[model samples]
Target: MLQSSPKGSSSLSDNDNSSDLKSTMNDISSQTNENSDYSILPMDVIVDILSFLILSKQSINEYCNFLQSVHNKNHHSIFNLFFGYKHWDIHKTHVVFLYRNFIVKGDLTPYESRNPSEKVEQDGFIMNYIFKHAHTLTVDYCPMTDTYCQSLRKNKRIERFTFIGNRKHYHSGLCSALRECESLKKLKLDSVYDWEFTKLFELASLTYLKLNTGMMLRDFPPQKYNFDFIVDIEENQGSIKKILKNEFSESRLKHLSLISSEGFTDEYSVSNLMKLPALEILFLENQKITKQSMRTVGQSNLREICFERCLNFSDSGMEQLMKVKLPNLTKLKLSGCGFNTSNLKKVFEPSNGEILNQLTYIELSKNQNMKDTAFSKLGSFKFENLDTVDLNHCVSLSSIGILTFMRSFSECIRTLKLRECNLDETALVTILKSCSKLQRLDLEMNNISCTNIEICEITDLSNLHYLRIEKNNLTDIEWLIALPLSNLQLPRKISNYGTMQLDRQIP
Candidate 1:
């Protein structure tokens, strides 16, 4: 049933040569002593063996020994097929050359060496090869030198680029190199800063952008912090707002993620993001954003939105968001956002529970204030298309609230997570009987006891493929053997019972 592409096709002449190579290999294997001459083998056979060795992640000593017999031209061909720009059409192919590893053991010199001239020559070759053909590249903790930058400018075909570095090293030339990548579509920069954001706007083809400042303010004690750092953060926030408003207004960016950028305050930075017409996915984490900024985000055409650790976002702002009419919204996550049930009800059944009808995925985990009354009100609404619900760490939700919520979406819910919720055995039984179509369920760290009644109820989950009940007070798991589960995770204490039951059922 697997289809082949034109690039994968082999010519008739190549196949005949491969057959001859196979016979030669068989004759060599039958000989008493190993043969060092591999010249009789066809190019396809050598390439196939090398590909197999790399794909299997096995040691290539045998192949390396065989390559010694190959001619220089054939060696270049084999390397091209294995690691060079020969097969650009293969989307899954990626060439990752770590600077530290490359400098120590370049492609030609696979082993370590002490000669400085040889190291320099191999490094040059690696850089040239990557610049000429690599479409995707990831450099780790490597300082971008002037030569590297110049080489990057010539490589306009790079579609994905990731640069990971430390705070001590600053790559000043990265900005200029990025501007030259006209074909770039995705870029991730970590621990890099002070680059002209306006240059990004020139990349009209960019669709995904991620920038992590990598500064953990929490690590430093309050008294040890310098006042200038805070001032610089505020300044960066203003500059980011200006760049977004001026440069990204007409860009074709669809996904934008900003992490640990403390300068991204509510008024200027978040508000400017709303002006991006082509944006659809937005992720904000560890930033200061208020409810007022939510108003601008609600008006945007974003179909997926995630807000994590945005302490300024309160219930009132959520109310404003729920009131907005977003026809295309489908996914929403508010993890670690200390909003209570009253605000959540507004989000679920906002504006008479009519808006966000297309919403299928909802995550309200770590909201300690979500209680029974909230679910009681939530159950009253009709989310006929709801698919996944995550209420993990909502410790205030008791059996009553959980039962009410489960019953509401029992018909359509396919995945449900209630980890660390205050659900008892009765609540677990109710969920089992209600969510008949549930395929994945996570009820870890609860008070549920796996009694006979609970086991009987679990047997009814015919469609369940994954079940996690770890850290619960499960005592009886003998009946778990009857369930048709592809994956199951039970508490450590009850794992012995599960193992014994499986052993008895196996043969």
Candidate 2:
């Protein structure tokens, strides 16, 4: 302790350096405090800047990306906002990324074994994030994801839901998900087999449902890939009855789209369908259900039915369909259907002493089997409320049918589309004379003769508002100047100045 030598002097020097370092640190701290005060701005000014940035398209995209990384709930909200617009390209490059993130955020993976408690915590967390404002959501073909499903549990706002199961996977979870969507009004399930259809009754608000392309095969049978499985006739009838019984008694369902699960074999299924008292619009496509079966389906509270490519539905079905009293029905479409002259005739025939008096619209395009007889049948009915009718590609039909059909309903019918119908000079003259109240007419690709004499006679269309007379052998159309038609659709042709004064041409 008393030694005062060179070593002791070095120790004292070290202590002095340590004190200098501490003083320098204190000075740096004081400088940092001054800089922080300078950087501070008013909260309102900061908020204004944030608002401007948030509203910018680029900013919204960036925020969504950032939010996706931090919270699933925020990501779902941002995703919905971005999709709300009709067109948005921000997610094009990052679609796969977004898909992956949706899976991770929802933790919606398939079950290792069936039990609710297995991933309850993860499912709840995912549900909390996804259920905020998504009224419609699709859970399609993502085999490993089941996390997002639980988020839908007890959600009050979801009205529409779609689930598409993978070919090899089980769709038990989809059934589970449906039970939770209590507010669901419209539902579509694709590629699901043996679905307990009765379970849908729990969704009391459901009004529309589409079931397409399901299978019961143990493996991917190549031939049956696009096919659906059929339930036993008794079971199918019971299920349909249950659907009708519960649907009207408990719920407010009005519209239903039933894509056939398979070719319906049960007469009971057909019979039970008519009991749905609340059903209004039914869209049946790609079905094997025949006209006989349709009578029962039509007997239900259905008003309108759209038939497309259901091959078995021939003229017989049309008769039965017409027999069904649809007081509120306004529209019917038979596009691409196999209807012939017999069915076409029924369309104009007065159902029960008065043409479906409430029927205002009818579309029967591409029924190549229709002809003059069909037109004559139409002349018998009074389409007092009819406004629009389309007979496009009815190639077998000639002018005789066209002339009479137009004359019969010309008083009420304003719009007529007869594209590609086989027409001649006689038919054209008859239509011009009969359709005085016609506002729109399409005679495209027809065989109507275009002689100067015939063209002169065409001036009678004074009430015509829209006219299409394209793809016919016409060298002159001088007679068209009589009407105040605002729209004219005609094919390009070299017309002499004497032919007609060209006001406006739309091809």
Candidate 3:
């Protein structure tokens, strides 16, 4: 029996996360003294616990059992097998070479069905051992000419399956294997297949599926594949429409994400995807969808929607969005969606002369077109339950709009990020004066010159912990001396070039 230190620390400095397990084992050992007549834990329990550690540590049971064997002075060659490689190469090699579940081709000469004289016992045994117990199985272009997929398809308990092969080989294997896999809930295939979807519909328990059709990187016959390229707006729309029409009709689908090299989906594809009854979250990136597509989302029961790099969703989209009755929607993200200062008025103006109360988090960043009016409309939106607002990298935004927005959510907002925004001393002072209930504030790479002075004024934010103000022209070291915060992110290089200038004060 071994007793670990109260502050558990492992000898293997790199394996710090294992300290908790070692400490728990030591505690159990100390309680169950070796001298006492105590019943040992069941073998099944040991195996179950060992399974979790299996992914991280190589043969952890062997190491602990070897230590036990050595403690009784009965060290043998079997104990030498407990020695693990210091690096990951041998572990990976073991998985690649020995693990039959990965389906790596080895010396198949002995496994040939015609070879009656050749020994096939070991290969059969290993394959049987793997297919009998493997929960997660991957087959990547491994030739199974002799034994059909039916031999390994009876593993009904397999929860995950990954297929990577040419169209003909992989689709046939999938169609064959799907008949026996009643327990498979997830399936990932990197290659495209002819629509053999009846096999997909058979699995009653299937809830999640991720299919990547990124292999054939070309458009239709007329259009050649563009190089040094962002996502083609036309090509992306077609791809999205294909998925929405064929694949996304699953009633159990809760989360759906389509990530192209670019970020955008057109209105038609977007409208079709919104028809999913159970889809709660949807992500569309790098497609040239306009505000009209954003309006289609309002008809669904979606709670979270993310639009990344969708350049055409301008102020008009925001106007249409305000009129949509989204009672369940909570989180909305518009990253790199590109909105200018003029469009801010249309976005933040009262939609149909009413406020949107369901949206809890709003993140609009990297839109170089943002102006003071944009922040002003955001400030006046009057969202009662809003908690987080991210307005980062709008360098043209002035204090008036931001201050007005903060006034609307002076109490509810918990996290606020306004990095690289054109906020000087005047803007920072206004935010501190108005926003009293913030928990985290990020004002990094801004045009602010008086960091220390502005920080001292923000003492009303009691729950504030995470603060970042990096790479700005604020050099006063004493600015943060009096503030009481749990966490503070200082500027990497504080510049002392500009004077502490302000246009207006809080009267």
Query: Highest lDDT, which number?
Result: 1
Instruction: Flag the better candidate by TM-score, 1 or 2.
Output: 1
Model 3 Cα lDDT, one tens digit per residue, 206-237? 66654444333333121111110211233564
Per residue, candidate 1 scores C-alpha lDDT tens digits across 14-130 of 334554544443443343123323334545554443333232111222233334444322444324333332112222233333221112111222223366666555455556556
Error in Å for residue 115 of model 2: 28
TM-scores for all candidates? 0.70, 0.63, 0.61
Model 1 scores a TM of 0.70
Q: What Cα-based lDDT does every candidate model obtain?
A: 0.60, 0.55, 0.54
RMSD of each: 10.5, 15.9, 11.4
Better of 1 and 3 by lDDT: 1
* Model 1 residue 99 distance off true place after TM-score fit, in angstroms: 20
Where is model 2 poorest over a 10-residue stretch in terms of lDDT? 91-100
Runs off by more than 4 Å, candidate 1: 1-119, 168-170, 195-198, 215-250, 261-265, 350-352, 451-460, 478-494, 497-507
Query: Order the candidates by TM-score, highest first — what do you get?
Result: 1, 2, 3
Q: Which ten residues in a row have the lowest lDDT in candidate 3?
A: 222-231
Candidate 2 lDDT over residue span 262-369, tens digit each: 542233344454455566776766656577765545445566777766667766777777777666778887776677776656666654335366767888888887
Could you give the candidate ranking by lDDT, starting with the highest?
1, 2, 3
